[model samples]
Target: MPANNPPDQPPTPGQEPDRTIAYRQHNDQPYPQGYPQQGAYQQQGQPGYPQQGAGGYQQDGYQQQNYGQQVQPGYQQQGYGQQQNYGQQAYGQQAGYQAGHQQPGYPQQNYGQQPSWQQGSDFLGTGQPTAPPAKKGRKGWLFAVIAALVVALVGGGGAFAVNLLSGGGTQPHDVLPGDALGYVRLDLDPAANQKLALFSIAQKFTVTKSSFTGDDPRKALFDLLKKDGAGLDKVDYAADIEPWLGQRVGLAVLSPAKTGGEPGFVLAVQVTDETKAKAGIDKLMDGDKYGIAFRDDYALLTANQDQADQAVKAAPLSQNTNFSDDLNALGETGVLSFWVDAGRVASFAPELAAQNSEALAQIKNVRVAGALRFDGDYVELAGVTRGAQNLDMGQPEASKIGALPASTAAAVSFSGLGDIIGKQWAQILKSADQSGAGVQQFATQAEQTYGLKLPDDLTTLLGKNLTLALDSNGLDGDQPKFGARITTDPAKAQEVVGKIEKFLAASGTAAPQLAKVPGDGTFVLASSQEYAAELAKDGGLGDDESFKLAIPDADNATFAAYVDLDKLEKFYLQNLQGEDKANAQVLRAVGISGTQSGPDASFSLRLLFN
Candidate 1:
């Protein structure tokens, strides 16, 4: 060990003394003025400290040495500027950490320079700075890509707009007779989105998916018709039907024939190729009692050749303003749509006219339009009917069922019921009797026994708005919690309730308790007083998410009904097993709502999915 070495150190046997300590001892002077303190290294070119070299930690003070290599007392190592040998290896020949020429295809990197990352080059290998490669032809390629995208978007958008304006494709009205009294059309090919939505929703349920076995719904339906024995036992769908069958099909009830028999009907089938369709029809009608006639793209089928020829000569239903207006008012047509001229149909059916002559007389003319639509979450059947003359249908009213408790599992409400009962009591009795139920006899006996008027008392009890609600709270018991609340004149409601209670007591029937709700002209007939009290409270059923989802327009509906299957499924499904239970589980709720505006009435019925 050398005596000049610091504590806890053993000097190399053949190495020179520590130069940093020896230099400071020899100078024996404080750091020069304007320079850093003793412990800090001086700036480059400052006296008493050596300038740093490219690869050396300190220049002209002590030479840089390889680890574990002994330094001779007077030996001086060269700086990076002058390459030299390290032991037997030359500086330029050392593989890594050497300040010299590099491997082929790589730039030379000086030792202790900034790393490659900061120099904008590959970091893992050399620390040399690299020039960025030119981005040749990128702008032109980018413009080409952008131009293609714009063209595709514009073309697709134009096609979509045209499809929407043209109503997707040809409709049944394009072929059926303009003067048809009744028409039912089925569109096996709906819009792409509608078809995809139907297919996606159908696939969620096993039973529905079975009916849609193929991507082409029309072919699936034709196959089903063949298998179901629809008088197509001898017809092969692939050979006879698929060759020319277009997507739209319609059945129309035409005017009575000139010979004055039953109303004639024609089935119009759209054809893609007239020649193929004619040949296919000849095969289908080989031994059948049917006749066919071709007009434009449609093949009309009738009972005989005369009827089919007459149908082709008439103006197409697409030109009928009444039919078009009615269907347009009903909004977008769905997979299945129908139109009915009520007066014309009634005039043809003498039996129906005779049975309801009074009711028919009120409406001079009526047109009905309806559609069956499918969505991802629900299936809806919607219809609209407009009458030339105002019928007994009443105005819409805000429903009180919204105030029912949130736990209500099922409810039905009606507005303008009192007026309906008052005006239609006689007709209702007649219809009831026609059904062979003896309702007139029962009503007469009830009036005599209770000493009450036929419909006047009944109307007073029913009132303007009536709602019936049932909850699952007590459904497990023998007597479920259920109640009916009616909006009526309080005094009249009380009198009618008293008369009804007395009538029930005299007849040896269990009587329900009836009472007027506080602060409102509403009366409740309930199985228990507690349920009646619940009916009176201003509850939040209207704000409940499930209620809103089920009955969206309940508040302003003339008539509405809702059932919460999610809440009641446990009780009803207790006895079910296997596929029935699984199918039932898919149903979440059901809702029906109807609105009337003057002579027009519209209604929707929806089945919601889980």
Candidate 2:
């Protein structure tokens, strides 16, 4: 169909002009041709070479020569097969060599298989063919190593994200503070907090939900820092020395011995950036006696240089045995921690000690430590008080303490209230006399009011383990119904209830319904006989899993209490309207529990909210 014919006059060998094949990407575009296209050639009957096409040889019968290969003698001249079917059988014949005769490592030629000429397949070489040049093994191995490194980097980054999301590791306690009557530490950046404080205060006038898109608490802080703590109206706190003007800072109340004269305090900051922190302090001091002292990266400031030096030289709070023990008991990583040396505080503040001498004397040997942690929907604060031998804060007992009924809204349990009451009876009587309750002569008053002879000593009716509870669970119709329950020795409880009944009869009022748990040693103070009877049938809180979770380790607890804030919040909200109701904040529950070892006591309060 297509025209193809030889030229009428073939050029003589020496007079032939050189020619080139040109390639154009589009019909309209012309590009100069590059290299001269050479024809392919193959020898017939060569052991590993392809066969000649159907044309066999040219009319002149001269042996064909390969474009770049040396030609062997006795081969017939041949034209190349169609290039579009390059890998197909040449002119209808298969390659000359049989499949089994392939070189030891050479790939077998298949139907339509392209010739790998660039792989240096030298057909002229001693009857052997070369295998594809060994792939760049070193380059492949290098790429594999790089791929592994990329995977490791990606995995490490993911791990870091997980750690940050899970609340990254806690640093060691701020050990810059020295021994003092009181010491406080916070796991926060003081500089950041100062910025946050300024931002929050300014937000009242300058910030609004629609205008501010960023929620990071530090954005405003950074802006405030740039402003040089200015623009705060009416005595800006940031303008003054933010004592906690560093990454970590603490306050310590040093005794007179360490303070040089007056009982003074020092603010110690862990200086992350010395230049910035120092500038802040300089602006605050303004030539006052309080100056900054640097110990390495830590900066201390106090009323005088001596106090600052004392804070630097004295033993750190981290090394204090009692304080560290208490800190561990509360949670080492809590947001805030504080310790109070009761003896030191009393000695430092003698004026207050003189006013409350008796009460102070009782707790003079106490060492108090507390910690605060803020979890989602929960704020927990725990305190530990380690007292000296003389304080006689009772020890735990093996027997179970009073267990309040499940319907209770709030309850308090204490170990041996009787012993403490007896020890402080005189102070108790004095306080009652001052209050007009006349408890100093309670026996006489009881006899006159109830027409019954009361025990001369009030301790006779008391029990070692006591529990008192209030029930407002039945609150409705804006009027809260209140019920009270007390647990102690069954015999002692009966005696006290009888005395109260007699007093009610003498007053000519309806006697309050009283019911007792059959074998649980608890008395229910109910609004009616029917309610009291109903209360006796329910299980106690001690058997409830939710109650146990609220107050854990009850066996060793010296005192424990649980408050159902949900019920309390509902009761209060029911009586409120409009803004009052909208602004009301409620917690899920609050559990306060304590443990006493010898004279030392530790207490924790767990507050849960919605």
- Global CA lDDT computed for model 1: 0.61
- Clash pairs, model 1 backbone: none
lDDT by residue (tens digit), candidate 2, 1-610: 0000011222234321111001112322221121111223434444544443222211233334344224445333232221211343222322222222343333433233221111122221112223432222322343233222222211122121111112111122333554667887654421111212222222121111011221222233434554785543332344444433443456777677632356667777666566767776665455556756776567877777776666667666566666666555554234456778887677556665655676677777778878654332344577777766565546544223334456677777776566667666667776678669976476677877764443322443344555555665556554333444444455656666687787777778797455454337655555655555545544476765545656767767877888776667865666755433432342367787877767777776776643
The whole-model lDDT of each prediction reads 0.61, 0.47
For model 1, how does the per-residue alpha-carbon lDDT over 360-458 read when each residue is reduced to its tens digit? 766648889998765556667888998747466566466777888888999998888788788778788888888998877877887888867768888
**Candidate 1 positional error at 434, Å:** 7.0
Task: Give the top-scoring candidate (lDDT).
Answer: 1
Clashing pairs in 2: none
Q: What are the runs in model 2 whose C-alpha is more than 4 Å off?
A: 1-177, 189-245, 257-262, 351-361, 396-403, 430-438, 442-462, 470-473, 477-492, 501-524, 530-546, 574-586
Model 1 C-alpha RMSD to native: 30.4
